[model samples]
Target chain A: MTAHTSSSSSLGLISSATAISQGAEAKVYYASLHPAPSPASTTETVDVLIKHRFHKGYRHPSLDNSLTKSRVAGEARALIRCLRCGVHVPGIRMVDAAEGVLALEWIDGKSVRFLLGGGAEGEEEEAADSEDSDVAEAAAQEDDTDPLSEYGATQDELMAMVGAEIAKMHRGDVVHGDLTTSNMMLRHPRSEKGLQLVLIDFGLAYTSTLVEDKAVDLYVLERAFASTHPASEPLFASVLRAYQAGMGREWTAISKRLDDVRLRGRKRSMVG
Target chain B: METYHYPSFPADASHVHIALFKNVSNAAELRSRIVRASLLEGSEGDLEREAVNFAFIDARLICSRVHLQTAIYQAVLAHAQGALRTKTVHSEILWTLNPSNNISEAIRRYGVSDTTAFLIVVRISTANDANVLANMQAVVSGELSRFSLEGITDWASVKKYYKLNSEPALKIQGITLVQERKIIDEIVTSTVAMKSVMT
Candidate 1:
């Protein structure tokens, strides 16, 4: 077993890469990972995303503690399961349940949210500046639409990627409690030929075979779409189409269950 | 020998050594033996120290290299992120093997035991890859005389400690005993890498 023992004092946490993405229960930071030395390896530069489950102020102490710990643990476990089942979920690089943080392989492309004009203002500016450079480099290549739009993936295609990946995850009995376009990234591969449509943020994931849980998972994504991007019904439908193909027979019950969930809302009516 | 790698660190982490021993039968004996050895007097103490420098993991709880790697990687990251509970990365491995935060207890229980066959010993350094490779070869073939590619494992103790009498990772999975050992080796190896950031 090869071991690494860099003192925390030695590793200067590069603040430049510490871009934070505030989730509902956590704040994620894009950071650098110090690569372990290898024989064939030449360089030591790597980037990773650190999902920090920030302490919640409203919840009771004990409940908050366990919830944070379990959620972090659950996310780590789900990622491992996804890897085993051959889903392209990012590999787990590090976890700190106590600190309520998880470090994962960072994808080097824009999130689906940013690609669709939902990214933060600062990133949007950077994206715009990158586009300005691209245009200035070649006036002949001056495309009217933004450069990110030139990635050539329609909204429908991105949604299908989300659906297929989620279906594969569900098939492995992992239920993502929260799924949104913001949580998914369209990594335009480091190279021209790279896989895209990566689903992330498994903090709320759980291992379950309950039909209700899976249905609820899809329902949550549906609601996320309706709220985040208006008139996205057609785009979401395409996602479901791909999801159905990946799910096969399992889609029938889940699709019906999703309708029931939608009617009742995310919180199932206990009155009945 | 099984090789493990964690690409998220510096260049030295690419080299890994792992070996798995299935059906560890004498866990109790190994436990007692480790305990007794720790209490031994004079030369016995030195012999025990030299003999037990590896970790004795319960193979049952381990799912895969990725599973173990995540755990190790997390520990390393914890330290790199300035959150190590223990004082060193080596101790961090012991920290991870235990569920709670008792440092001494973790070291004694999970560090090394008597019937431990599923032993993974890793020596990590930031030296050149050629030196690292040479060190690994020297350690396995020279200083560690008891270790062998075919022989030097105590499987019975591993099974007993891990309670691997029934675990899906070991049972339901379509892998041979040799393959199981390889998997175990990788997990242990990854555990070592993650410990780098401990303390």
Candidate 2:
């Protein structure tokens, strides 16, 4: 981890940004997009969450550059598509495809997974490398406090938001390849935008209008819930109900396709 | 006038010295001067070019600071990589802001024109910003004002240029004026940020 940090500091934005989490695909950091306003106004700085997809040593440099460039482009494209569709995703702040960096509007809030008692991301993976941050996180997590209550929202409300947002994305013909609770965030209630559910991390997202593709999206999130949260069936039930309402007339075909997807799992049955 | 130093950028192109000029009386003259500077030759050429090196942008089409900064960031990034499509980093910002890849079209639409009343002059410099402000003022004649896009932005021109005329995001009937502008700013800013990859 120290080695990664040292090498990454060469990139201006990533070097200045504070690392938040590290996944296999990219490293996430918090950074401001523009310079701070004059101190007289005392206005808060507008921040962005930068996702840097670092270069791989094993791959050829030429191959690495093209792959990184395309992925950065693809993710930015997906995000803009979702934004145009009115999905509550973070706005794109900047894109440096050459450096494989994407900066998004920094969402001020907690992830749905953490709010629901699933540990914050990278807990086990980061424990060894980042003991200080782990300790700080542990201290922040007080006992007997239901984090979700602080957001002034019920479980049903969050589920509804999640479902509705996915419906909106599907309607836009963009499939969020990775739709886990960790990828969903609820804005702090006191923030300017107020309480809102935000879907994020569009790394694997792609454009597809197929009902089967959309159904598989729901299926992935469903499986994510089952693995991460206990008694998640009821929670996902509310999600589905809200999703059905949002889907409207399109719900019939998707729901039918979803059943087939459930029986055979995410992939469709291949026939000769 | 606002001076922003980007530590992320190298020293040569790190400092972004921007001044918003209102009541610009030299729009036509400045345009010709830039064209003349480009065609200049020898020692006289270098000095004349340096005098008017700042980016003289049409403030009407700019929806917000983010809209402008996104273009500047991409321009500087291209410069750093030695892949700038335009002659200099200053002109590349105009190219980045434009939807199409045409260099002349970008300058014609976003750069200084005859009737440009509000002008934004940008100079990417080293940390040593001595005389940079003076150089900007010497090139363009206008009253310096605080940066703000309120009432200055021509939403119609921005919408037309970015091809948002029929976009569903803006076409929804009865969308409030503020909501419309916010949507435009977001789309325009993002478009500039991803212009390089955008086909």
Each candidate: fraction of true contacts kept? 0.12, 0.38
lDDT by residue for model 2 over B1-199, one digit each (tens)?
Answer: 7777677776798788778899999999999999999999999999999889899899998998888888988888888777799999999999998999999999999999999999999999898779977888887889888888788999999999988887756765687898788888888888788787785
- Write model 2 residue lDDT over A167-214, tens digit each, in one string: 888888999999999999999989755687999988899999899899
Clashing residue pairs, backbone N/CA/C < 3 A, model 2: none
B1-199 per-residue lDDT for model 1 (tens digits) = 3344544444543334444444454556655655676688899787874454334444444444344444555555555555668765545756776544578877666654444444444433233434433433432321222223344443554445444445433443466677566434433332333332222
Task: Please state the interface RMSD for every predicted structure, separated by commas.
Answer: 8.4, 3.5
lDDT of each: 0.59, 0.85
Question: Per-prediction DockQ, in order?
Answer: 0.13, 0.44
Question: Which predicted model would earn the best TM-score?
Answer: 2
Off by over 4 Å in 1: A1-17, A35-41, A55-64, A119-143, A146-152, A191-193, B1-121, B124-199
Cα displacement (Å) at residue B17, model 1:
13
Error of 2 at B64 (Å): 1.5
